[model samples]
Target: MTLKVGTILEGTVVNITNFGAFVDVEGKTGLVHISEVADTYVKDIRQHLKEKDKVKVKIIAIDEQGKISLSIRQAMPKSSRPVEIDWQGERNKNSGLSFEERLAKFLKESEERIQDLKHREGRRYGTASRR
Candidate 1:
């Protein structure tokens, strides 16, 4: 069967590498890049996947040269995906504020975040370097 973008299919893990895994889908091989393996950080590809393992992957892209790019993360159900913070939405929710008020509030929040980051860096290293 021909592979098409956005199609979810079952494939066998033909090979595993430090960067990614190769999956066999209906006689075609596709690379599931390490970042596409899971929604969270994947320090080692083998920690999450292995050879000969059957996995459900979504065909995310296909190049003109017939290279297939798959995503095991996208194949997962939406309910299981990570919750992304909607920063823009949160800002827009306070749209009733005056432009000046909004700007002042944003500046205050930015300064607070910068200080917090610096504090964290100071704990990690000797002293926090000003950005």
Candidate 2:
């Protein structure tokens, strides 16, 4: 099969290293970097992949030297991806409130947070101060 950029294929994990995992795709080996292993932060690639494990990977890049960069996360179907939060939609849900009302609410919440932080700090270090 002609493996081009954006091509998705199933491969076997031939090796695992601290930096990345090597996958054997149709007899060709490609490097799936630790960042490409998952959508979230990957502290350790071993936790997500193991030698001989079958994984679907996307051909993300191919350098002139013929080195292939793959991504297991990108190969996943769009429906399986995490749902994004719509900040605008959430804000619009409370559209009935006026601009001044929103500003007042925001100021009240901010002041309350500041007061809470100060209270916590006072408790942890005591209100007494040294000269």
Query: lDDT of all the models against the reference?
Result: 0.95, 0.93
lDDT of 2 by residue, 26-97 (tens): 899999999999889999999999999999999999999999999999999988899988899979976989
TM-score of each: 0.68, 0.74
Count of clashes in candidate 2? 0
lDDT accuracy of residue 94 in candidate 2: 63
| Backbone atom clashes (below 3 Å) for every candidate | 0, 0
Candidate with the greatest lDDT versus the true structure: 1
Best prediction by TM-score: 2
Residue pairs in clash, model 1: none
lDDT of 1 by residue, 55-111 (tens): 999999999999999999999999899787889998788889999999999999999
